[model samples]
Target: MRLKFQFGSFITFIGFILSSLIVTLDLEAQTHQFKLIDEETNRPIPDANFFYGNEQGISSESGDITINFQPTITLTISHLQYGKRSFTAEELDQALKKHQLALQPKSHNLQPVTFISIHPNAGEQEQMTLQVQDKLAHDAGQVLEQFSSISSIRKSGAYGFDPVLRGFKYDQINLVIDGSQCATAACPNRMDPASSQVPLNMIVEAEVMKGPYSLRYGNAFGGTINFKSADPSFTDKANLNGRMGTSFETNGEISRSEALLGITSKHADIKLFGSLSTGNDYTDGDGVKIPANFYRSNIGGKIGLKLNSTQTMSLQVSNNYGKDVDFPALPMDLRKDDTWLINLGHKAVFYRGALSSWSTTMYATKVDHLMDNADKELNPRMVDANTSAKTNNAGGRTELRFDFDDDWLYAGTDMRIENADGTRKRNMLMGPMAGKTLTDNVWQDARIRKNGLFAEYHSQGDNFHLVFSGRLELNHAEAQNPDAGFAANYTDMSSDIVSPALSIGGTRTVTDNFSIGLWLGSAQRSGSLAERYINYFPIGLDPYEMIGNPELKPETNNQADLIFNYKSDATDLNLNLFSSFLNNHISSEIRKDLSPKMATAPGVRQFVNVDKAKIMGFEASWKQIINRKIQQVAELAYTHGQNTTSDEALPEIPPMEFRYRLIGSFINKKLRTELNFRHAFEQNRIAKSYGETKTPAFNVLDIKASYLIVQNLNVAASLQNIFDEAYYEHLSRSVRNAESRPIYSPGRSFYFSLSYRF
Candidate 1:
């Protein structure tokens, strides 16, 4: 069913609000938009500082800003390379009429590595401005892992590189796309995670927050990562534009290609995009072929309509498909997977100055997956095994913001409903039950629904900035059909839970070039469908069949962070020290009293609460612009996690790691070269109880170069794993082979790309 039909009353009320905006007046007299660009190159400049009236804000990617329109007002803008400039009322009026503004360059070259921006959110730590030549990856997770130190990926096979952050993965880390969270994985082994399902070619920007210091984006227990797409824009003149790109890799004989087309008029715009990727198994550093082969295709489009000067509406639709994917880490391989998504959005600036603006987004998505061991050498009793699963999700969020000079108040409501079902067929060719087929319920008609209300307040002063937010949620979960014996073990097959979350953060300027900040937060995360409804399935990091616990309580994370920052004309540096304490942490314990249901797995484990858990970490980042020709970005991060109740180390904590990137510009900024290096320290703190092993240290180097051949055409090339180093991440899962060792990294590989835009 459509999300609108599922949320009948809610959609009706929001629609009424949308209609009522016509009569409402924006008393603030705001609505002027400006795009800041380089005076010499005419390219957009990010992280520019602008001040007007009582508001001082930083420009986002491409230096786009919207402010109150006042003929008598004066605006001041400043940048590291562009220096400072002031625009008088007359100049502002002229710039507004022409719809073009530029700042003079103070140096011969322009370089930007990392900086802070105000909108989007206050807690944003980093932003990756994606480009066609830079983001040549098969999935979104690969694109994210290169952007920040706080982000990592748990590689499963050729397809699923699920995102991990701050020692948390899966449901603990919330990943959203254009304000909607709807990725639902169907495989118990997570062969196709949320990051893999979202079309990577559609993303224009990626941003991340370090911790759960905000409540406006759902129950973010660990942190939040938001993937943003190009907003459909209306131009005064009719325009038709598009971009196409193709890439090739020597290793695994990989090939990838994507294309985008857009048409815009005075009041409407539409965009279409598509991509295809195919690859075979690649040899590792040891000259051994890994089980990594896959084929994927994606198609998507977006539409936008400008109702008036104060209102805009958008709609998006997408489909993704995968086939013949191999997963060496798991017992089953992905035969086929398909996903469909539809999203609707509306925004309006109120009249009469009663409300600054209000926006709403509603989306529906579904994933259908099938996995089996058809290629594997079948065991005697378990000749063949096949499981089919699917997940359906529908959700919406609406927010109303009121601006008051240097402060703003925001109130919003969000809701999500999900349904899951799956069945596994086991074919017997030997043993006592030869030539007989057995059917087992993996997820017997499970459902999870949640409704939430949230509020946020922001205040800014000459030397300090403060942000406060809170959220209240009501969650419901149930299982309609469960195995008879499993049902009898846990009588309560349903639960209704109430969860609350809040956070407060403030930053103080201590001196001319130094600042300090502190953040404290607490969040609650409810159990997932598998955590509460799975039957006898080997779904955990261990090799034990797991049973569900319908009566599981919500987990909580109480966290604090101490931040130090320093900024200068040529460099920006930041350091963060953080700790998290958890209560009611969900864990698995062997259920000796129960008998095994899956023949290959003899042990049975049940989900339970671990009384206490903790994770502590620190991160340091540095960005330096050297002489406007060479810029460098570096990061160092470390994390330690433990099950405090059991006095043991956590299972999947990553080791200390460091990364560095150096960029050099030549030929009037048309040719760019970058060198990348990474080092990971050895990890000896293993969770022996979970059969975890130690990992050795390793280092890798890479180099890339891109050149603009013409006005709108570019060529790029890169060599990865330059040393052909054989290594594996500490968080890598053990493969299904008898050796039980993690998969090795790929050997030296070369890639090339050519792209054009008009």
Candidate 2:
């Protein structure tokens, strides 16, 4: 991969933005001492800036501020960790005279832990912040299902539930680890999304942006998922700490073991983490066994150097291995998989001059995937077939931040290069092709290069806050296939495309407990390698093969969002409405005129660019305290999508769904319990041209509880599918082993976990 850089042009652009920072000051000064802290954690907010008119000062390491302010001045405070807030000078003076001021924490939206369980004795407490160890103990090794807005598209009854957001899937969503882009799935069927590469025990925090609001992340059309790893905790003197945990589930006979160790010092810290998980075929409702089994192991470590209090540098590396991974819904099962990832980063904060902070990071990842059909039963004794795919990705970003009196600017540039290639081989065992082997390159030598420059601006005033952002993007892709013959001419192609994205949004506070906000954005997505180069690739759960169209145009999306939020001591509510109009949407179309080779083949579809499409939806979530001892949380989501040009519903779209939880706490907050209910409406809309299938509605209930046996040790138990109902999700794949029946979710099962830290 090659990239062209214009440093001179970028320097001139930065100079122009800097020119706006040199204005004259207007102030009536009176010295005052103040402190800023987070309302939720009561922790000091370092480097928070306080502004009065044109006078500005930043907080010290301990969040202490000594600033001169006018009696009539309106104090505006801002921080990257926290959004923005404004207060009257008199209010601040009163709080300062009394002590520290606690700023109501802004919406973290950083994929914080959302509790879904109910402890019989616990009341009204729906969510609890969990450490790495606690999360591992609570979750059944399912990493991506932690977010409320995200749901998984299960391939089987076992591991690897591909995450789906809103109505978008696959490349539409971007997944980043430690601020670096990750490699795409080596399997055309996407058995291995980026999230599956890291075990839950390795994640320190997960952040999700719902839409294309932040331009810093690459091509964030659907959204961006940032997985932050645990950094070494530092102390005055060097210290060694460690933790170990294990869990088991009765339904699938699943078990997981994890361990973590760390060494921390004032200036340096290092840590290592590892996990091993295994599960057997699970039984669905009616006691029918489901052929879903998998085994996975992962190990990772990070080393950090403080480099003083204002600057830091870190390096991280990880590897994951999988074996006996079976996908009953897909054409092939994973025989083995190996993945490796490495990243290095440097950051500097509290710097002098207009550059309040600057950071740079670099990362690379590689994946080797192999799958075959040796375990499946074939009607006619047939040959053996296997696929070997590999993908590599490397990218880095450098960003600069500037803070002013009432506004801030964030600008950065990032680039990601990806290379993928694979081969499929079929050996004839009993047919005419028996004793002979035929091999074809599925991906060829395909490559994709994406380079982008982005900037975001945020400003605060009396009663409203505004955020504006934009990105300039350029993309290129090419593939080489020699043995494809006519297919080569059809799939061998090159593309160089350029596009721009813009978004502007604002929030107006109706009152202290309620707010209304709106945003409109335009984003573009270039065709992926598999969308442009793959030949006869089975991307779905069925035997349908997909052909790439190299001459495809980039898809464009124009969307609008409206949000209403209300928060109080006893209740919290959020409602969101969104609509998107897409241009040149790419989807599979059955084409019968495929040269002579596949003209009569059933389910052979080719990717085609459609003229128009629309996706609109709404999501509502409510949490209310029924009493001091019990709480309730409910969420509802619905999405409708169609090919406006064809007047048909889109294929593989999820159905309307709702989830509710009843929670309770007891034993002085040491024991908690939750009762959960989930419902999905039947999906009748089908894309007949694309061989779509309809699914029936489902309802399920679950119960869970957790308790602290003693300090540093915890125990949890859960009963899922309490009624043992037979139900399948709308997005579940048609199972091959079950005569094309949709794979049903796991049946009644009991799970228990325990952890102790030392």
Candidate 3:
């Protein structure tokens, strides 16, 4: 009986071992699949080198190369200039099965040989410029304050982001966030739909296209700023991530807490980002308390799917709410402002041969806003004034690129439809005394439709390169208002513009450490709605009001720019110079003594088409890797603008500025610190309508430090306005009161953040 039991135990042990081996073999047989792509354009990459253990693989010629391997094999993907990327066997298997892997292209060698490469977000290619990541800010209003070009940032009582870009306010420049355009209607007070609704922390990056090179964005006469958010990452594996932070200021106001939560998996990725911030009224540098206390709350979510190797679909929804936000410069304060956003998009790429590579995207957006005046009793002019506004936009874009041997060519088409509607009502106390006890209610409705087509060709060789490109656009606009008390009937304003763009540039390597490049280019832009049909009250100008012209024609501009770049292993420098000439330039001018009813006033401002204008500027930037532990960077920008029609300085031109930065890293890459300083030459040549006084120049300082507390944890702290400067920025608006109260920026402030990943 003992012998029989022993035999049975031995047989059972052998069977169990065999079963375990079979399961291991089956798991190893499961293959992992993945696709690599360009981060900027979402295009697949080809001819990339991939390695696993001792095995090597290369991408296919069509940029759609695939790799298959066991779940336990460690993998690495790399290219000459791009940094190397490594993934564990399990991670690769998960990503391949789910299809959510993307790689950033190497930038050092990616510069086009024959074409003046322009990124979709970065307007026209003028010179090398630094792009800022939006995640550095806690809110939209705070994000704009980080840029040098922006002088003042404010939140309307209605909870919108109102920014003064290079001294130009309200409608002078075009703002685009995730392919959506914002519209202003109601009250002419611009109380709602402020840039603040889009939280800065949600933005991935912001590209500022300086000058008129951004004609494609809209009728932007000044420039275009495109705020892009981070794309969702989808991988075969399931992962979760979250972030939390807090901030404080010296003005006795404690900010509320904020946090973010997100998750990604092979089948789908979902992200929920939100923040709740509240603070009491802040005091200025001199201990003078400003009554503009504010609180804000925002939430954003995105759902993304990996449809297949060549396709992706995504849906995004976001909302922002603000309350009791005050503006010292405005006559009235904002009581409540709300913004809602919804976006859906699809991206795909098709390849047929050496000559067929194309990409397409379509999207739509809607914006709604409402605003009411606070302190109405103190400001009788706004006692009974309120405004409500809505804007809708839809657009589609397609591009086809072909490559042949050493030559390449591309063509693209884009179309967009935009509609804006709003209403403003005045209370009985604010009724016009001279006019019929004005129950003034103004309604404005307008439509803008545009279509554009463009093409470019390039040929590159070892010693030389050449490129040519052109674009033609057709625009149609119509505005109707039943209430004549505010706007006139500008039935239809249409034009077909063929704005040809050309660029020629070449590079020659003179030595092992130096190279020379020369470039020249030109572009054109049309007028925007604000310059066309704006007829509203002027808050900045004491006694004058602004009226739009219905008969205004399209403005045209011609520009040329040159750039020089030099680089070595440790140091790099870039210099640029550009000039632009505009014809039929649209500007607001005051007609002296034109209105008999207001004869005692200075004059009335009206939008008019000027005969000519010119702008010239230069930018220089240098970066030095100094040593293994330290790096330094410096930049300078100067712009000079003039109205040739009147032979005077332009009203809202940016001022000369200088920036310096130093970064230090210690304990390998574990601890880092940065110091930044900026100086601006005050803009003295202010437009009459802008203000009655000139702004003084000032200097500002900022500091940041970060430490990796552990493998997956990081802590950071930052200080802005380190010196507690009391001067107002040139971009700040002036109140209409006799005291001319200028909006003062926050004195000194501090913020701390913590992030963890698992």
TM-score: which candidate is best? Answer: 1
lDDT of candidate model 2 versus the reference: 0.72
Local accuracy by lDDT, each model: 0.76, 0.72, 0.55
lDDT by residue for model 3 (169-269), tens: 46545667653434333324554434665655556456565444334344344455666665556655788865555555445464655556778887677
TM-score of structure candidate 3: 0.77
**TM-score, per-candidate, Cα-based:** 0.90, 0.86, 0.77
Quote the RMSD, in angstroms, for model 3.
Answer: 14.0
lDDT of 2 by residue, 348-396 (tens): 6532356566667777789999999888776664767889999988777
Say which prediction, candidate 1 or candidate 2, comes out ahead on lDDT. Answer: 1
Best lDDT among the predictions, by candidate number: 1
Off by over 4 Å in 2: 1-38, 41-134, 137-143, 146-148, 481-483, 486-492, 595-603
Question: Candidate 1 or 2, higher TM-score?
Answer: 1
Give the per-residue Cα lDDT of candidate 3 at 340: 67
lDDT of 1 by residue, 109-228 (tens): 111112222111101111111144434567777666774444444545456887778788888877788766567788877777888877666665666766777677777788877776
Local error of candidate 1 at residue 433 (angstroms): 1.5
Clashes per model (N, Cα, C within 3 A) = 7, 16, 10
Q: Could you tell me the lDDT of residue 661 within candidate 3?
A: 93
Candidate 2: give its CA RMSD in angstroms: 6.3
Considering summed lDDT, which 10 consecutive residues are worst modelled in model 3?
Answer: 123-132
Q: Candidate 1: where are CA atoms >4 Å away? A: 1-32, 36-72, 76-86, 97-130, 148-155, 351-354, 379-381
